[model samples]
Target chain A: MDIRRLRYFVAVAEARSVGKAAERLRMAQPPLSVQIRKLESEIGAPLFRRGTRGMDLTEAGQALLARASEALALAADGIEAARAVAAGSRGRLSVGYMFVLANAMLPRLIPELRRSIPGVDLDFAELSASTREARLLDRSVTVALCMPAIHHPEIQVARIGAQPFMLAMPIRSPFARLGSVPMARLQGRPLIALPPPERDPSSSAVAALLRRHQIVMPIASRVETVHSAMSLVLAGEGFGILPACARLGAPRGIVFRPLRDATDSIDIAVCWRRDSHSPLIRTFLKCAEKAVAPL
Target chain B: MDIRRLRYFVAVAEARSVGKAAERLRMAQPPLSVQIRKLESEIGAPLFRRGTRGMDLTEAGQALLARASEALALAADGIEAARAVAAGSRGRLSVGYMFVLANAMLPRLIPELRRSIPGVDLDFAELSASTREARLLDRSVTVALCMPAIHHPEIQVARIGAQPFMLAMPIRSPFARLGSVPMARLQGRPLIALPPPERDPSSSAVAALLRRHQIVMPIASRVETVHSAMSLVLAGEGFGILPACARLGAPRGIVFRPLRDATDSIDIAVCWRRDSHSPLIRTFLKCAEKAVAPL
Candidate 1:
């Protein structure tokens, strides 16, 4: 049966009187009775029995009521889900993000997105700047939070926020006593560098900053992520230069100090394919913008 | 936008031409172009650009196309889910059943129901015959499979299958060695009987069968279900009379043999509220009937 008929049936069943049901439904009793009669005939079962008091459900009537209610509820949910999706507040959003950016942005964005679009399913994966671009091109991820260095012709980038570079050192190190370490003080020290400039823009930006200051820092190790660099620094391997966002959840043994002579900072942005248009992606972008605005 | 507009957009996007899209949609190109223009205007963005080769999607066009396609798919799924529920091929069916009969019926019925209604979510709970009636009446369960002794005025019962009385004995018992055991042989022996006749029809039937055969078996204990009786039997407490369905998944330590003098069988039936009209219930009943027909 259609939703209208089911609704009519539920009103009549609940009211147990045609006149009362019609009154509640804002309809005439005769038309309501006719519809109920039509529904009973369609199913070939009498849904109601007239009694001395009023009317009561027959065995088949009770059965129909149970099913009709469920069917109507399911139909309503389906419609709501569809409308929500169309409104860009429902469906799945796969987000690719840098580990450091996620630590800063996700804590605020995830909860706010959940509150705003309770129907949307959020999926996340840790990705470097280059990998995020590849995933965006292939449509593997709906959006990415990374450096604003995307050069792909089909990728669109929107700058969210920027954070200046900071030095991560062992908490007990001599430099930890200083509020900020000068570029000159870091000369000849073992430095933990990020992977090649081709794969990571943050590390490339750091390298350029060091070169601009004419600091001849000896590279002790190269790592793929800020987390790994932090691990190495925790082990007293070398000091690491990372973005300000990376300091959000730094390990207990690590301390973050600003570079005294550094004017360069990492520009963080949200990226998606220029050819892609998903409501989920749009909603996510909006959420990302709102999250970064507060910072 | 509505589903119709989204459908038109998807067709145009896929074909990359208004003419081809019209041909596929079986409409004139002019009207299709008008609709697309209207959609673009509504979104406040240019969705496509006319070029010498063909039409190319603008940045906003790509975005709309992606979201429009997803919204349409979700809407389609919602309709399908609603239709499936109406046809008894979707939704959740919580079934209350006896442990023994479930072993006999579920293995066949569950897969058959899944095949028939792939969208239906099946949930099962083990319950006694009396409990099944209570659950059905309270609407805690959608349907139940148990002994056909439901006396509730509001409950409807449909007999699915019946199983003749079988003698369950420990593997080491002398009766286990026999192909079939006569009622007379077990006279005056300790018998693990099911709970008194009022709550269980199977036990009541067995008691009546013993009275007809003039066998005076002394009861060792009175348990609520065949599974409990089987456990006691396995411990060499006493021989037990149970429906043949109980033998389907009997544990390794127990053996089942037909009772020589017993002709009465326990009638298994599916039950629901007499007034219930649930497609899920109807689908479940149909599945149970098909499952029992083979047996």
Candidate 2:
């Protein structure tokens, strides 16, 4: 039977009379009586006995009473669960972040998230240039923290922060003593290059930035991750051009200096699918903005 | 949310387009779209992206999908469970039977019930005269197998079978040699009477039956149960008057002799509260009829 009929039956069973039940339900007696009769006929069993004194529950009525209450309670629980998720207070959020962003940003972001959406589960996926766009598109990750943030028709980006390009070189290098270096000074220098991003595999972000500045740096070494790039720079094999935040986790004996000639910088961005309507993704994006962006 | 909203959400989520989902649901598109919009607004989250191509589930929408299906399924299961109990096909049945009737009736009844309603859990309560009416009215027992069946305003009974009163005396007793004995011969003999039924305490059934025949028999002893009455008869305290079924479990030394010249008999009946509308009770009563009645 439907929930409304069960409600009426429970009322009649408890009150032991349709008149009293109708009063409790705030309805007239005749309609309540009709509903009870309809329920009994639908169930193919009598749910109550009409007596001179009042009414009495049949065995069938007793059976339905306990279960109907449980069903109603369960339905209520379902609605509350959906509401909690939709309100962004509860759910799972898989965040894909570049290693450099993870080092500087997570410490600030995690605490903010705990305070705001304590019911959400956090999943961290370390992103590589090749996987950044794929993870967001495939939904393996709901949001991403990317440098030189992804540009795609199906993707949306919020620039939480930005940092000027910096050079990673051995402490003993001649340029380390000079402090900042101009883009023209690095035109003929051997450079450590990272694998190209998923969206543009023809050239790395550093190479593209140099091309925009009319500087042509020769590729000395190519590596999979920023750590490997730093290792090469530490070994004096080549200098690495990196986001300014990368200095936070730089290897010992390596120094990062800003490139002075160009104002070129990379975005510390939160990216997600353009169509993603997940409340948790939006909630996380706000926290990310707070954690890393300028006031 | 209510089950209907969840149903619509699931349809749209699966179809990935409101127009397509509306077609599948056999409703017009605009109304379906309106319902989906109402659900999203009520949930306070965007459940889908209204892209030109089609609809896509938001993270919150994904979270709700699995749970919504579960809630709908649970509601359906609840209705099915209630219908099963009301249909008399599933539930528990508590049966209270007089000791003598239990000896004969249960064997036939239990098997029939198992065949007819396999889901019912059977509970048996042995009834004594003092607790008979109280058990039925208080609902401690749903149905009863009684001899000299109960008579009360709120109790309804159907006579399944009956047997004339028979004499239970020791094998070595002088009257044991006779095929039957006249009620007049029973006059003045010591009798073992059971405690009176709950409704009447002034006289036991055998005492009342004797009074109906205008014959007076001396009360040599009184006992609580049929077993005790048989034990007293075996001890030569008094002869016992019992229904024929008692012979099934009678002690080896006792012989049952028909009482000639007396049409007085005890009914083997199934009794329930007049107010009881339990389908299971009615179902059990029918099985009782088949088990103990002749045609």
Candidate 3:
């Protein structure tokens, strides 16, 4: 039976009098009586017994009462879940970001996003600039945090934060004794860098900054992430240049010093497809903006 | 947005061409294109890039595509679930019965109900005859199997099976050595019976059978269930009279014998409110009929 008929039957069963049920349903008695009769006839059973005082349920009416309520509740829950999904206030949002962004950007952004849009389920994955871009294009991830601002026409990028360059040295290294490292301290010292300019624009920006200082340094090693570069520095392979935020949670063996002649900093941006219509993505971008505002 | 627009958008996104989507949907191309445009405008974003090759998703379109499909699916699941509930093919059916009926009636009936209805979740509760009747009247349980016939006008009773009274005795007792116990042999002997005739119709039927055989026995104790009666017999408190099905799974310490002079058998009926319109109740009744047919 349809929901309306079940509702009518429930009312009649509860009230026990056709007149009283009609009053509770805000309808006239005749139509309500007709509806109950129709329901009984459709099920091929008598639902009620008309007594001098009121009405009493037959056996079948009791069974319908239990099921009808559950069916109505299930239907209502489905509709509400669907509406929540369509509004982008619920369902899963997959996000990709760089490893370094976790400490600086994600700590603040994630909590705020959860508080504001509590219904959205969040999933995170660490990815390089190229992989993040590919995942965004293929719709595997809803948003990404990457470096040096993506310039694709279909990609939208919003500046999250910029951190000044810092010199990372092993605790026992000679440069660790100095409060700050000057650009001319060592003309050919080994320096650990990230991926090349073609794959990572942030690495390209760092290379340009060193050139502007006219400091020549031999490349010691190349790594894909700041965390790996830190590892290399800890092993005394070479000193490294990284964003200032990396110092917030660096291990005890690594010492961070300011680059005295550094004129440029690394830029991090929140990126998504420009055509993304999800309110969840829009909400996340707003949270990202708030997180980086003080940085 | 409504389900129809989301469906249209998913079609266009998947097919990558408005004309192809229209052909797949069995509709005209112009209206489909108009609907997509309307969807884009409503979301305040350009969902597709109109290239010479075909329509390609913009960033927003890709996001919408993921969520739209999930929302549509959720809505459809809700509708289907509700329809199943209304059809009585789904939802829970709580059944109450005495312990003895479990051995004879439940094993055969439960499997058939599951096979026939599939969607209805069957829940069984072992209750005393009085409790079963009370639970049925209060709607705590959907249907019940109990002894004798319920006399209530609002209750529907269907005869499921009849079991001749069997004498239960401890294996070490003298009565256990007899092929069948004569009614006069137990004169003045202690008897463990169910609730008195006033509280239980099954007990009343047993009392009437004893009277017809002219056998007078002193009541040692009264219990609410056949399991409890069997426990008393096992403890050597008294010999008990129980249904024939009780013999099927009786412990090794107890021996069941046919009453030599007993003519009346206990009548077990499946009972429910007569007005219950649930397909679950109807299905269970039919299954009950099949279960008791061989007996």
Candidate 4:
């Protein structure tokens, strides 16, 4: 049944007069009468009986009235539900994140996105730069927060901001005494903590930075989560490379030193499918733009 | 995009040879070639490069391959999920139960249904008989394991089995001495329990049974749950009416005796919507029949 017909029927039923129902519906009486008659014909049963007194109900009319009430309720609920989704108020959004942006932007971006779109459900999944590039092309995730590497024709990237890499070390170590850690100081270090060995650009970027200073030390340990690596560093275990955002979780026994030299600072970008048209994607993109505006 | 075409394209991509993919797909190579060409034409991009030794991916071919794989995966998952629901292997089934059935068939039927349909998700709700009747009419629950009542056109009921109503009293009560409780013995004895003022057929049936014997007494109390009513009986606080199936949880202090010259019996039925055509409805009806067969 057309939802409009049910709404008109409900209004007529409630008003008890066709003229009053049309007035309440803000439409012409003839159109309202025609819609009700159409509804009756489609259902093969009259919804209301007219008499000199007013509209009353036949046995069939009573049954239709009950059914019409339920059908109209469901229709109203369906329209509202559709509107909520179209307005980006309700739905699921799977986000792919790179380690650098995950630490730098996620804490603030996610909360802001939630406030901007109250009912947009969030599902977080970690994606290395390699997998994220592949995922964006395939539309596996609606949005990807990562750095732009080799650009693919099927993907679109929105540059958010950039941050320089920082060296994380034990507070009591001699490296902490330097105002800025020298590139040569990291040379031949017995060990360096690394992010998960998955093809994350952050890990590769750190390796490249080390390589630029002619430092080639075998990775001692690889950790999946940043918190675990931070905990180990705080225990005076080993030195590691991290972005400025990772510095937010600076443990009491750990110190961060700026890198003195680099070919270029890292840039973070939100990557999406070239054809993604979801309203939720636009809402999230807006929040991302606001998040990186000051940075 | 057609899911079948996507599957065929994936096979070609993985094999890198249309002839080999056709052989693996158990189809003629000519049709597979035509189908792939049609797909390329539809997408306005050539998805394969002609080579003498073996087929290789052009840039467009690689992009289409990724998108095709994703589409095929989602289509396959959606079909499997829908089929699982149809077969009662997954998805939720909300059930409503009467108070007496909750005490009797619940303990056995619940566990049996779970064992028989391991993946049949259940959302069992405690409901009064009147509420169960209304909800069944509204399609609020997929099924109602309840007693047969006044037939309504919108509701469908299938009789599972019947159990005789028995009288229960404390072991110390005078009526417990008799092997079977006689109608004359209950006269003017202050029958401590009866149905609440609501329109429950079980209570009405019991009341009709009493009126047939021309016996009436002040109701000492009215309780909703069978467990609570049984508690009152076991405490020597009142004489109560209970279904024979409720003997499963007979407390140590209580003794039950069948009523002689009484036509009171409880008939259990699986009630549902008369016009429910949902596949889940069909599968659950089958499971319920199998579960209640032992009774």
Residues A1-295 of candidate 4: C-alpha lDDT, one tens digit per residue: 3446656766887888889989998989999989888866655545566767667543344444555565444433433443454445665677888765665677788889879877767888888644777776665677887753436687777777776777788888898999988777787764456543355544567777776777776666666555567777776667777766777766688888887875445667777876655677777778887786665
lDDT, candidate 2, A102-142, per-residue tens: 77888998899888889988888999877888899898998
Ranking by lDDT: 2, 3, 1, 4
Q: Which 10 residues in a row give candidate 3 chain A its minimum summed lDDT?
A: A74-83
Better of 2 and 4 by DockQ: 2
Docking class of 3: incorrect
Chain B TM for prediction 2? 0.90
Q: Write the per-residue lDDT of candidate 4 for residues B152-235, one digit (tens) a residue.
A: 778878777777778888888888888898888888765656454355534566677777888875677777656677888877
**lDDT (tens digit, per residue) of candidate 1 on B45-161:** 556767576677654455566655665554445444444545565667788888888777888888988887786777888888447767887777878887645667898888888
- Which regions of candidate 4 fall more than 4 Å away from where they truly are? A1-295, B1-5, B19-46, B80-84, B87-92, B148-150, B192-203, B231-237, B250-252, B277-295
DockQ, candidate 3, vs. native dimer: 0.07
What overall lDDT, based on C-alpha atoms, would model 1 receive against the true structure? 0.77
The segments of candidate 1 whose C-alpha lies over 4 angstroms from its true place after superposition are: A1-295, B15-20, B28-34, B50-55, B84-97, B102-125, B134-144, B148-156, B167-191, B196-203, B211-220, B234-239, B245-260, B272-295
What are the clash counts of all predictions, listed in order? 7, 0, 16, 0
Summarize candidate 2's per-residue lDDT along B4-110 as a digit string, tens digits.
66788889999999999999999999999999999888877777867798998766677777666665565566556667777777778899988887767788888
Q: Alpha-carbon error at A282 in model 4, in Å?
A: 31
What is the C-alpha local distance difference test score of candidate 3? Answer: 0.78
For candidate 2, the TM-score is 0.81
How do the residues A1-295 of candidate 1 rate in per-residue lDDT, one tens digit apiece?
3446667887888999988999999999999989988876666556787767767875456656776666555444544444454556666677898878777788889997898778777888888744877888776787888854566688888887888899999999999999999998988899898875575544578778878888877889988888899999989999999887788878898999999978788788888888666666677778888887765
Q: Which residue pairs in candidate 4 collide?
A: none
Model 2, total clashes? 0
- Candidate with top DockQ is 2
- The C-alpha TM-scores of every prediction are 0.45, 0.81, 0.54, 0.46
For model 4 the local lDDT of residue A147 reads: 55
